[model samples]
Target: MITARYHREIPQRYRLEAGKCKKCGFIAFPHRLVCPKCKSQDFETIRLSDEGKILTFTIVRVASDKFSKQTPFAVGIVELKEGVKLTTQIADVDVDKLEIGQKVKIVFRKIQEDGKAGILCYGYKAVLI
Candidate 1:
């Protein structure tokens, strides 16, 4: 069973949908009701570009209980070609090889499972391109 919060994010998670502010040209992921840049409530729907570059990253040595089994994984803020900066798990690369400006592309993957019998949450992860 998935929580309401998770269910609400299905669109963004599965489709990489974003809302671009109609006035300021600012794009917000997860579809914010208010624009963070210019206080505008109007926006246009946009799909985020899958290709991007690693702006920054950190190797997670400690994680929450849900992700304990995936300890030491790398997470990074990737700036997509559309100029949207989003945090995502960096996958399929050695920690030593991680670096700023490394080219990456979005890949759909299982983010986590809520419980032993819970639903599997799938989302996009950044992978070296």
Candidate 2:
């Protein structure tokens, strides 16, 4: 069984869906029920653009248990074209080549597996453009 945390994030993880506040135009990823900027409950579901730029990043030399085998991976906070920023792993490039302000595009990829016989969790990763 998928964890409640993982299950609830399917929309944002799979489709890049976000909640845009109708009152103050604040876009919240993971679809918050309330607007952070204006304290409004009015929102419209919006799909975020896949294209973005790398705002900041870090190389993980030491990783968590789930990501142990993938140590030294590059992760970044990417700012999408629509101004929504999301954290994602940077893929398909060498760590030495990564830089801030680099253009990237989101691609669906396997994020992790639950266990030896567990479910495969898929999510978006940033690919250099």
Candidate 3:
């Protein structure tokens, strides 16, 4: 059985779906029922931009058990063209050369697996453009 958290994130993880506040034009990633900015309950589903620029980054030398094998990776807060910012792991680049303001594009990739069931979890990762 898929975990609740994983099942809950299917839309955002697979299609990059977000909720846009119909009343105030605020976009919320992961689709919130209530708009944080204007406290509005009305929202429209929207797809986020696939391309973005790195706003800030950090090199992860240590990571949780599920991700330890991929340590020394670069993770960054990317600002999509629509102005939505999301934290994602930067892949397919030299970690030493990563910098803020660098261009990147999101790509679907395997994230990790469920221990005993060997369930493969997939999600988005950013690559230099």
| lDDT, candidate 1, 1-129, per-residue tens | 457878888889988999999999999987899998889999999999899999999999999989999988999999999898999999988988899999999999999988888889999999998
lDDT of 3 by residue, 63-96 (tens): 9988788888888999998899999999999999
Candidate lDDT scores, in order, read 0.92, 0.93, 0.91
Residue 111 of model 1, lDDT score: 94
Tens-digit lDDT track for model 2 on 1-129?
477878888899999999999999999997888888889999999999999999999999999888999988999999998899999999989998899999999999999988899888989999999
Winner of 1 and 2 under lDDT: 2
> Where does candidate 3 stray beyond 4 Å?
none
Residue 127 of model 3, lDDT score = 99
Which consecutive 10 residues in model 1 have the weakest lDDT in total? 1-10
Better candidate number, 1 or 2, judged by TM-score: 2
Candidate 2 regions with alpha-carbon error over 4 angstroms: none
All candidates in order of TM-score, best leading:
2, 1, 3
- What's the lDDT for candidate 1? 0.92
Q: Positional deviation of 66 in candidate 2, in angstroms?
A: 1.3
Highest TM-score model number:
2
Q: After best superposition, candidate 1 residue 86: deviation in angstroms?
A: 0.8
